[model samples]
Target: MPKGQEGRGIIDACLQALGEVGAVGGWDSSSPDGVRLDGARLGVSVTGPVDPATGRLFTPPNTDSNLAGLDLGADLARSTGLDVRVDRDTNVAALGEHAFGAARGVANFVYMTVSTGVGGAVMLDGRLLRGVDGVAGEIGHISVDRVGPSCGCGRRGCLEAIASGPAIARRAGDLAEEGGPLHEILASGRALTGKDVDECAAAGDIAARLVLESAARAVASACVDMANAFNPELIVIGGGVAIAHPQWISRACECVAREALVPANRAGIVVPAQLGDDVSLVGAAFL
Candidate 1:
């Protein structure tokens, strides 16, 4: 396990989970020091300010925040007893794909995930891009609308707040309650999940479709901005919501081509991603 922000709780949970799973010679960095294995000494490295109120290091929960992953990694290495390897989660995803998946031979590409949140990573000449402090490719926090909903990172109108799976479900649930049959169906379920919303949309439920369209539009708008900025040859989009609705991939590409700079629009581009739920796990294992 690699610890960044949310380290303490994640570390505790991972320790319990690992024990339950019979993991041996485990590695974890759920602390500010460095990495820790079972019964090991601590290493020290510089990270960032530990939040006085929370007693936890203040790392960026999303791109909108000023903190960076390098700081987190250094802190973990210093405080724990394991060798810590760190990079943005999205960057790791891109590396995983380029090393073994759809982008194996590609030299320029971007990887994006659109589930509870939206995230992105970039590859150039088959190498992952890690910005200063290893915080490159954080697309979720990109400000799309100046006055849109407030993001988790205390920002307004980020791509994440508008297009992530949870965002879609929230919007859909709100719309469904306005006398739609889909709303009634979702209401009867144990919980209103993003999967349910996508299924309903696929089944021609008006409310569900509306919600999906809203999210898709926001995602498309963000993709357009990214396309213009990076102009990569391919954009691989993964995550639960996107995998459930492949049409969203096409729609996003269309929106980008229609809205991005002329040169970027002219570049041959496509949207796709291979690994699904296992992406994060695989990347974690690599770390």
Candidate 2:
């Protein structure tokens, strides 16, 4: 989350940006959407599970704000004076990739993000798969360990707990007492981040390598599962952690090739996402 911004505050800032750009003359905040803006509509992709039908948000375990039950679409429409549509960030990113990036022309694929937390969006036969409750692509919550570190979702041993960005930092912190380069960094009172761990691994720090390798394996395990179940033509991996460390994508590709079932292994190819940070932003336009 941005510094000191949440809920309506973030929305207000965005509305302000639109005004500055002359996208909208000005927002009253009282009168809402349903008004057209040169026949344009706004598509917003946000973190966490979204109600597929109603565009309401559920409390995302990773988010500091409890956005549960919030009707973001209605609010944005009301304020922005344009038709508004909302979807989970990963879902839109998958759409973005399919429409313009790595998965272009690919009919079946999964877009996975290994950033703040592991997330996924599935495209089956060229359509987004939204399960009954609109929370189908929650690959991060899948239990890899019956008993392991707790996850933000209040589960034990989720893939997020093992391989997400914060998980990398936490794992490094746990091993910091072993007196290695990681320990020295922690000793300096610098909070460890996934980028820090990746850099350390690049520097040949044993503890950092161990932590990163562990995460890689966990991610690989999930990729194998996705391959077996979805049999996607490609699994597009993105997000800060994977983009910063290509090793994660390589590890997933290697694992899938080795362990996925028969033709499934041959059919699915894991690749890095091409759109970079603008992926979801581009995807939102398609919403």
TM-score of each: 0.72, 0.90
On a 0 to 100 scale, what is the lDDT of residue 87 in model 1? 45
For candidate 1, give the lDDT of residue 146.
85
**CA lDDT of each prediction against the hidden true structure:** 0.64, 0.82
- Per-residue lDDT, model 1, residue 163, is 80
After the best TM-score superposition of candidate 1, give how far the Cα of residue 205 lies from its true spot, in angstroms. Answer: 3.9
Instruction: Give Cα distance to truth, residue 174, candidate 1, Å.
Output: 2.2
Assess candidate 2 and give its TM-score to the true structure: 0.90
Q: Residue 179 of model 2: what lDDT?
A: 62
